[model samples]
Target: SKITDLEQREKAQYDEITSLKAQRDSMFLDNQASQEKDRDFLKQKISDLETRCKAAESEKSSLKFEIEKEKAKLNYERDHLESIKSEMQETINKLMKKNEQLIA
Candidate 1:
């Protein structure tokens, strides 16, 4: 009777150990799945950030181009106005010389 009780106790202990090992394995798998989800989430975020950065860079380039074009237009207008002023001055000088000759 003593031997039989000892054998039963050993069997129960072995069963308990197996149960605990199964629970540990389940927890480990759950942890691995959680880590995988986090990794995927981070990867998606990085991709989104990269896309935004590209868009910002493109916009900056476009704005710079527009600024340069506007500057060129302003320069052209300034030069055109200067040329008109020079022509008007020459006409005035010619008219003054003619008037002086007539008076003399």
Candidate 2:
């Protein structure tokens, strides 16, 4: 009777150990799945950010080109105005000299 009781107790303990192991393995698998989902989410976020960064860079380059073109146009207009002003001044000086000769 004593040996039989000891055998039954050993079987119960063995079953308990097996149940505990199954629970541990299930928890580990759940944790691994959660980590995989997190990694995927982070990768997608990084891709989106990279796309936005590229678009921003392209816009910046385009705006810079437009600004440079405008600056060139402004410089050309200023130079043309200066040339016209010089021509007008020369005409005025010649007219004044002619008037002085006629008066004398």
Candidate 3:
């Protein structure tokens, strides 16, 4: 009777150990799957951010080029106006000199 009791106890403990091992394996699998999902989500987020960054860079370059073109046009117009002003000043000097000669 003592031997039989010892064998029963041993069997019960073995069964409990097996059950605990199964539960541990199942939890491990669930954790692994959750980690995989998180990894996939992070990767997609990174890709989206990269695409947005490229588009922003392209827009910035285009805007810079347009600003440079506008600056060049303004400079050309300024130079042309300065030349016209100089010619007008010379013409006024000629008119005043002739008027002074007639008065003298």
Residue 64 in candidate 2, Cα distance off native in Å: 0.8
C-alpha lDDT values of all predictions: 0.98, 0.98, 0.98
- Which runs of model 3 end up more than 4 angstroms from their true locations? none
Q: Show the colliding residue pairs in model 1.
A: none
Clashes of each: 0, 0, 0
Per-residue C-alpha lDDT of model 2 across residues 13-36, encoded as one tens digit per residue: 999999999999999999999999
Q: Residue 77 lDDT in model 3?
A: 99
lDDT of 1 by residue, 1-104 (tens): 99999999999999999999999999999999999999999999999999999999999999999999999999999999999999999999999999999999
Once superposed on the true structure, which residue ranges of model 1 sit more than 4 Å away at CA?
95-104
Model 2 lDDT, residue 74, Cα: 97
Q: Rate residue 51 of model 3 by lDDT.
A: 100
| Candidates sorted on TM-score, descending | 2, 3, 1
TM of each candidate vs. truth:
0.80, 0.84, 0.84
